[model samples]
Target: MYNLAKYQKLKNKINRIERAELGFFPTQIYKLENLSARYGVNIYLKRDDLSGFSTFGGNKIRKLEFLFGEILEQGAQNIFTYGATQSNHALQTAIACRRYNLNPILYLVDVIGEGIKDPKANILLDKVLGAEIKIIEFKENEDEFEAMYRAKAESKNYAQEISESEDDYYLIPPGGASPLGTLGFVNAYLEMKAQEFKEDLNFKNVFHATGTGGTLGGLTAANKFINDDIQVHGINVSHKDDSYLKEVAELSTAALNLLGIDFKLSDRDIIVDNNYVGAGYEIPSTRANRAVKIFAEDEGIFLDPVYTGKAAAGMIDYLEKGKIEKGSDLLFWHTGGTNALFAEKKILGNLLDNHI
Candidate 1:
């Protein structure tokens, strides 16, 4: 059902956008033979976890390739981003900035009470990269969202004070959810489509973790662009309200517009399964821990507690509940955050427990 002419046109439109080479292209896609047998469906994986720039690569690398391209084009020297103390986005941004010789300033919220002592996982990686790190703790009566908003405001003020000129610094939103960053996943969607055509396979469903919504927005936009019927399902890693779908739709439309595409996406076109977000973001769930072990033991692949583990658990649940039809073809996008395995015990939960 893929039209070569249309695909080529879309590819051309995407190629016109500026991008910095950051990660390896078309990060491996292959069949998950063992899981397929277990689930009674044809299972495949888009290995974005191996999307390299570092050994701990993840989904953020794709967004940074475009985001940094824009920052470099504008000739900014200082890059400021906000996230949790162990944010994969913040870590990836710091890595990309180091490669481009730009300064990375991170305003990170302490969501898991990492405290002021020795840091671990991505936080430790940020320090090793020499990023100017500022940890923001949640004040009394403040929730995670409030603390995140405060972190952004505080980072903006700090950037203004340190920058010699407005052009000297650039601010990136958490998860790189901006339109330009969303374009990275739009490109990723095309990459998957190309693979699908080459392999003569038609995927009925696509699954991945959704946080700030940029990746979901881009993939949805690309699906709309090609008029594909593949159902792209986002498994929430955190709590999000009904408005989250609308926000993702807006992001998708904006990214499509950047490519001169006239198609628009609405909330009706988005799909999110929130059933797997056990105990909210960064807090591991029993099913997710079980899913992690299953993947490692069966497929020899690792998934982080924060993102991929939750999404994978959701996919498995759908299959088990008969929400997805037997014999359906499924693609799981491994967006990567395996570094979190070495993070705090709270995030890791009972992952290694024999009873999980």
Candidate 2:
């Protein structure tokens, strides 16, 4: 129920932003003929994985586009954000901050070991991007981590330490899921929707991993603006609880409001299935590994076990179970986290052992 005139106007603004060349290009969308034929459904991949720029480009970069734009518009000199030890969002935030010549300070929670030997591959990129890292123990209260980081960013002494003035912007939780930030993914959806007509195909369901929820939320809200029939399914790769669901809904509502789209979305619109995550966020599940191998073997596509693999597994499960009707076009979004594959070498040791 989004206003078409306002949606078109928002799409125009997004197109202007795209002309700036802030991130990579259209990141291909090719049909997965084998998988489609096997499953008796039309399947395509929106390869955000190919979003170029130091391997940091992915769905998160789309979100960072608007976030960094706001930071620059505010005349901020430094950027602050927090995440786990190896956060792709944090790494990409550092990259965008560098492009804008703004200093980035990353607060990592429960991080172990410095400089290499970290189980997360983004650690190396974090250092390479020259983002100042602070480790925090979050066992007691998670709010302390945010309070301490925000205080540090606001401190005159800390501002001098990063060689910045008191006027700087700090990004709140999970790559700025605010309405302003979600504009990036909303534009991305517009891009895909344009491609839909050119490809002569109609997509029914769009699936992606819901981690911090920004990508899925923005995409879902934008979908309502573009095509109401397009349903976005967010496969939760993190803990599936009420809090996470609420976060997704809130972000989606913000996104809708940002574009001046008056759309009423219920809980049913936000579909999050959390049956796949085996352990924690970075841990790999057995089903995800199998999905990775199957995709590699069948489509010659490599997927990271943490995000894309689990998402693909959920998509496949939905396909096999009749949830996704036959001939209903399915688009699986590849949010790149492939670097996490090499970070956890022990888990992949058996695959290499065969050749060794």
RMSD, every candidate, angstroms = 1.1, 3.8
In model 1, what lDDT does residue 355 have? 92
Q: Estimated TM-score per prediction?
A: 0.98, 0.85
Tens-digit lDDT track of model 2 for 1-356: 33567567767756554222357767789999889898999999999987857656778777777776667767787677767666777788888888878888877664332324453578778887788887655444445336446444544345566545555655545655677677777787878876887988788889888787888788877776554578788888766676676767777877767655576555556778888876756566777777787688779988887788889889888888889889878899998878767665533433333221
* Candidate 2: residue 277 Cα off by (Å): 1.8
Task: Please identify model 2 stretches exceeding 4 Å from their true place.
Answer: 1-7, 13-21, 111-120, 140-166, 346-356
lDDT of 1 by residue, 99-169 (tens): 89999999998998876488899999999999999999989999888898998898888888999888999
The segments of candidate 1 whose C-alpha lies over 4 angstroms from its true place after superposition are 2-4
- Model 2, global lDDT: 0.72
Measured by TM-score, the strongest candidate is: 1
Candidate 1 backbone overlaps, count = 0
Provide the overall lDDT of each model, using Cα atoms, as 2-decimal numbers.
Answer: 0.91, 0.72
